[model samples]
Target chain A: MIPYAELLGLSVEPGETAPTYVMPFAVDVIGRPGFLHGGAIGGLLEMAAVGALKQALADEGAVRIKPINLTVDYMRGGRDKPTRARGTVTRLGTRVANVEAVAWQDEPDRPIAAARMNYLIVR
Target chain B: MSDSETPAGRAFDPRRLFGGRFGGHGGRLGIVYHDHGEDWAELALPYHPDLIGDPASGVLASGPILALMDMATSVGVWLKLDAFKGHATLDLRIDYLRPARPGRTVIGRGECYRITRSIAFVRGQAHDGDPNDPLAHVAGTFMAVEGYW
Candidate 1:
């Protein structure tokens, strides 16, 4: 696990193929008195995006992944609960990859936040 | 000294607000105040091994930087309004120009450019050392629960 992710108490749950990242609601991830910080959710989304990209690029050998940019939309206030996030690799090219991730607490259909990320592949 | 000399100082004191508590996530990240203006605020993130994203490169993760900018912009909104308005980040976009050098503190400066009745527009950049060469650029908006007025 990335040290920052570890510090945030983010863990991975194995899926059939890829993995879903989960962040526990804790003091380290809190922003306001009652709500989760925007950054923590953003971080979880980034981790999920990276995890999916890595899984997709597993056969490519030691290719390094670099983030180009990310846009995050906060749809709802994340309450005190374990938040889950998963990523979809929208496009994987020779030079770049696009990934999208969403975080939700109760229902996957209703997300608390969503992120679109682009990464540069260093081969 | 005078009224004009200290408008936000009277209401939204970032120093006193964040003071020793640091408040959860920011506290865990070891972020500290750097400076501020009437409509802008700067915060610094100290280097720590625990925050590294890429262990091979020892570079700090972008997550912490995003968090720093979020808080900085949040403070910028309060500074501009001269009070701490209840608001939440609606959306934020971050463009990574380059990775920060290992073992250096990162400085994020956020500015609130406009404030309407319900939204505050913000933009900022993060730099490890030279302000001219920024590591990331960010723009976003916050939705206020109460009218910003």
Candidate 2:
């Protein structure tokens, strides 16, 4: 189990194509008064991105991945609800991988937050 | 969350806001108040195994650092406003310069450079031991729910 995910009470549900990361609204994730913390949302998105990267690298036996950078855009304030995130690997190269993730509370079309990330992969 | 609290012109104390043992995620991650000024604030994130992103390296995850910086910059905005106006993070971008060394505390400092009627712009950096050698650089904005003075 990922320590940070466990800490946030984040769960991963395996889907047919990719895994979806879910973060429940709890006292540990509150930012202002009732909304979710941006960093918590960012963490869930990062976990989703990493999950997608791992799925993309299933063929490789053992590989290490390190995060290089991330840009998160908060479109809407996260209300007191379960937020779900999914990552899509845009470009997976030999040494670098680019991933994008979106997080939504109710509707998939209406994303509350989105992020693009770059990771360094050591084969 | 308005200019009401600014009536007395008392400064917003982030340390007081983060009082007690539990402050949600910030407290759970052991983020403590380090220092603050008029428009800048610094926070400390102690090393803990629970925050390790890579178990083999035992290095802290980028997420926790992001959280620290977020709170730091949020405090910076409040400090700059000199009031506790409610605000939400609009956007944030982080560049990881290097992974933090294992078993080391990280210090994150944030500064609010600009504040408009409804938005605040901030930038910050995180360092493990030395302020000169930073591990992460961050830039972001916050949207004041109430008008910012």
Q: Who wins the DockQ comparison?
A: 1
Give the CAPRI class of candidate 1: high
- Across B1-149, the per-residue lDDT of candidate 2 in tens digits comes to 11122225556766678773337788788988788878988888999999988877788878999999998999999888877898888899999999999999999999999999999999999998999999999999999776786
List TM-scores for all candidates, in order. 0.95, 0.93
Sequence-dependent TM-score of model 2: 0.93
How large is the C-alpha RMSD of every model relative to the true structure?
2.6, 3.9
DockQ of each: 0.93, 0.79
Clashing pairs in 2: none
Q: Which parts of model 2 have CA positions greater than 4 angstroms off?
A: B1-10, B20-22
lDDT by residue (B1-149, candidate 1, tens digit) is: 11233443366777777775487999899988888888998899989999999998999999999999999999999988888878999999999999989999999999999999999999999999899999999999999887786
Q: What i-RMS does each candidate reach, in Å?
A: 0.5, 0.8
> Model 2, range A1-123, lDDT digits (tens) per residue?
778888889888997656999999998887777888888889999999999999999889899998999999999998988999999999999999999999999999999999999999999
For A56-90, candidate 1 gives per-residue lDDT tens digits of 99888999999999999999999989999999999
